[model samples]
Target: MTLKGQHLELLPVDSPEYKKHINKFKDLHLINLYKIHYTGADKNNNSDDSWSDPIYFHGTGHCGCIDRHIERRTGSVRISVSEWCQHDDGCETRGILLQGHCREHSLHEGRHYFSEDIEVALKYAADGLQEHVASDNLSNKARFSLFLCKARNIHLGHEAMHRYVVSDYDIIPCYLVIVCRQL
Candidate 1:
């Protein structure tokens, strides 16, 4: 009444597979199985927002509701956000994707951030870092803070929950992910 290798029915104790099964049981090997009922309209069938957030932002600020930490925690390292914002269609990400670090400009749309732009980016990164601290995951917030505290060159702000930076190495004048989950 039962088939071998693909059925849940009890096998005869005299069978060869019985020893294997017994061995597996003795070894305490746990096996889990699930039958997923996934319809094409997954959202329509069941809507859940239990795991939407993935980071938390924390630290100091001047805002009434939230802490608005300034860019320069010190007067040494400079920070700035990325050049291109709307990464849709034929955006700057297109070039970075094709040529592996922007063909024309210096990573951020060829714009070398010097004076005021650095301040803007620092502010943005600070806000972003804070958001990460107060959100869902604690590790992300810590990584971003570490990167922010140790960047040397052009500081790139958060995009899609990751921070970028132009490395100080001259040979490879490119951007690097300073803060992000290992993907």
Candidate 2:
């Protein structure tokens, strides 16, 4: 329940103080880290939005949509990444579409972090979550994962605070952590 770090402590999920620690950055704007496209679908309906296959792409701007519809070809089509916030008729960047969507405006408001908050929040996610899991799960008894790696590093290394905001396990963690490790 209590996570001890070099300078701070955190509370992982399933603990009482966890919610409190998560609140420190509640007001921060979250932006998309990476566009992760999941696949697999049930037999209920095959709408255009149904998941067909996993299309993982690095960097922003690229939407993971492939032409796999009933009449479309298997892999002959691609939707060019929208450089602007194409989320509701807001893609009017640089003339009529010359410069395209800049990184600042091309984020999923619901899943990623604001360009500004990414730096401050990484430590919390890396150190906070790591310590909480360590303090609660490791120090107590038999543990499955002693160290979190890669993307898990942010969540296991500390704790991306906004995770509590979206509350979904599939969303991307604050990616500025990509640039974060350098800091």
* Candidate that scores best on lDDT: 1
Which regions of candidate 2 fall more than 4 Å away from where they truly are? 1-34, 40-116, 128-177, 181-183
Q: Which ten residues in a row have the lowest lDDT in candidate 2?
A: 144-153
What are the root-mean-square deviations of the candidates from the true structure over C-alphas?
23.5, 21.2
Q: Model 1 off-target regions past 4 Å?
A: 1-97, 100-110, 114-175, 180-183
Ten residues in sequence with the least summed lDDT for candidate 1 = 1-10
lDDT of 2 by residue, 1-183 (tens): 111111111122444533432333333322111211112212212243432222211122111111011132233232232322233343121111222112334334433221223334343333333433444532222111111111211122125332211212222211110111211
lDDT of 2: 0.23
Each candidate: how many clashes? 16, 16
lDDT of 1 by residue, 37-135 (tens): 112222222233331121111111111111122212332222222211223333322232223232244535543222122233334434545543454
lDDT for every model?
0.26, 0.23
